[model samples]
Target: MEKKIVISDEQLQFLSKYLNKKFPNLSPQVKIELMDHLICGFEVKGGDDFYQYLSNEENFIKGFINNEVKNVKKTYGKQTWRQFFSFFTSRELLPITILTLFIIFLISKSISNKNAWLIFVVSTHLIMIVSAIFGMINKKPLRKLDEVKYLGAEIWLPFLMVTLADNLGFKNWLIQNEFIFTGYWFFTFIYGVSAYIVLRRQKKIILTKYKALLN
Candidate 1:
């Protein structure tokens, strides 16, 4: 019986850093999986000459990433977009979207005065900023669901962009303007709903695809 070779921690760190440079876009989850395969599979294959063999054949790493990693990237890309579009089209999201619309309509009716709506907008945004900062400060260990960070960004980017445009005077887009105000609230509420979807969907994905790895 032969003893299996195990990769050293220093070597693992070096591999992690080198591969990170090669595939900087890979999620932390993907990077960890690569390291797992290299340590468990590649290192074992070369046995006594493993280090020397790996040093001479860096292309092996590149080939693995270009093939395996790219495929993973594509699958992730499609899943990401589908989750986003789900906000607009999925039957599950339909009720949430309707609820958000009702909230916006109520906001509009509650503050018929333009100046009142301005105050509401400013106050609401201030609360949102504080909430985001607090959430970031207390965030827990990253799960695959936490990979929903990108999807979360997509949810919020619309509001950020609209606000940026208004502030930059791209239009006389005052929050006091009923159209602009409602549009902002619409995005915000949709974002809230999409966030719920992200949490649920990412949990499913991790359990379905990475259950063994997670366990």
Candidate 2:
């Protein structure tokens, strides 16, 4: 039998750091797997020399990272949707809706009736800005993979609100009628909750990956 391919402690540390830099865009969970893949490839394919094996055309780590990326996309996609939808029934969503309704109701009662449209528009900006701020604080390093879901999703509410606001007559209509206001309230409520969920999820992603990168 061939001698065992045991990696030294120093070699393992070096490999871990290399993998972290090589796949900075990958989430830590996947990055950990990539590190293992690289090491295993080096051990199995080496002809007595680790450096030679890594430099050879047959290095398997690249293949491993590609396959792992597919799995990561599928796994993260499902979890992302679940986390997003969970906000619908969450307690935080209720208080926000009630508060929005109360505030908008007050604005409708006291605003220069001509500018009631500003209520939803202003609220939309506030939610999106808050989400962006949270994202800024919980920033993740740039990765090779696509990762704009959190902040990207957060902007849709503001975009929609701006478009709705363009039709000044309809916005006034939404503000003036209790029935129409209910629809507007529901829309803003859903968006606010969704934006909150996305921002929180982004924070979790940054935290999870940051720990992995350190190791």
Candidate 3:
């Protein structure tokens, strides 16, 4: 039978501090993930002394951490896109999806084009603000859901699109052309909902994964 390695609380704290020095802006979730990985590596490498093992393999460990960071960033992007597309294609969500489209269509039709565009853009910004606030007000000791860090694309992509549209004079073009404006409005709403879904799903996963640690 393989011997089990038990990591003590003090040792865990040291690991945490070491990671902070290594990655000043590391997310709580990623910090925890890397800490677990380091402990497992220590066990497999026949280490009775964690600090000594880390010192002996300092260069290798740094390279490994760097690779893991890249892998995590890539995986996060892939998971987000997969979740966004899955939301649109799910059979169970089809009816609600249709209803949402209908509501957005009605909203676009009933309001003046310029007003509708303003509302869509403003609401998107408001959602971003609320999401940031929500992350800050979390009472958990370790806040895994840092909105700026995790949802960088979701929060800023729409704003960037709006900026690009204005710079390209698409805003005036969109408002002047009712058909195009309606389509743009629908796209904005759908994108916002998809972002919300991604945020909720991510928060759930992080909370579930770190439930014991949080408590």
Candidate 4:
């Protein structure tokens, strides 16, 4: 025999709000079907009275929202990883590479001390390589792969400037003189821009994913 289930006004309101957000145009039959399924599931899960079940249901809804928030955060974290690798392979990594080469050239030109340059270059390269690898392995990708492509383009500017400076010998120019600390400012600007872009992208992706889950 199919058992009947009862729901409270509060539970009905909560479910209605949730469903309306997901399906603003949802048909009456569809809403009824959803409510029926939910009520049946709630009854099976062990609430004997409508009020008791509604209480439990409220808690369940709260927990569900909490979990969804966490998942959204996780999704954003993955997108960040994607951005990191994309940035690394695209342009941000180039400045470091150029800087290393410039350091080697200076060392060779000045003291004929290949060892010092070798150590600096190798250590820096290894550190960067290892960090990239670790980030790739440990970082999660945005839950929705399609959203990854929409990441804002503005984040690339700082990287572009840094690369340009390094390539045009401006970075070396700054390094040779103690008063030319403007390069560091530019670098800091790049970091700040990258962080802002990543965070903004994360927020957008998370909200989109959460809204999609309602349907």
Candidate of highest TM-score? 3
Q: Which stretches of candidate 4 lie over 4 Å from their true place?
A: 4-11, 14-40, 46-48, 57-59, 91-192, 199-215
Tens-digit lDDT track of model 3 for 1-215: 98877887888889889878866666666667767777888877775788997677678657765676666566556765676566579998767767866776677678887787787788668767765655322535444334324543564566666777789977887776766766676566556556666666666666676577667
Q: lDDT scores for all predictions?
A: 0.57, 0.60, 0.66, 0.49
lDDT tens digits, residue span 1-215, model 4: 76755666787787777766754544344456656766777767755555565555655544544554455456655655565445447686667645644554555446533353344334434433433333222223343222333232233444455456558876556445432433343343434334454656555544555454545
Residue clash pairs of candidate 4: 78-140
Clashing pairs in 1: none
Candidate 3 residue 11 C-alpha distance from true site, Å: 11
| lDDT: worst 10-residue window of model 4 | 131-140
Candidates 2 and 4: which is better by lDDT?
A: 2
Better of 3 and 4 by lDDT: 3
Query: Which stretches of candidate 2 lie above 4 Å from their native place?
Result: 20-30, 44-46, 55-116, 138-185, 201-215
> TM-scores for all candidates?
0.48, 0.53, 0.64, 0.36
lDDT of 3 at 47: 55
Q: TM-score of model 2 relative to the true fold?
A: 0.53
* Local accuracy of candidate 1 as per-residue lDDT tens digits, 54-132: 5655776667656754564455456555665677797987787778667776776576556545544564465346435
Question: Candidate 3 clashing pairs?
Answer: none
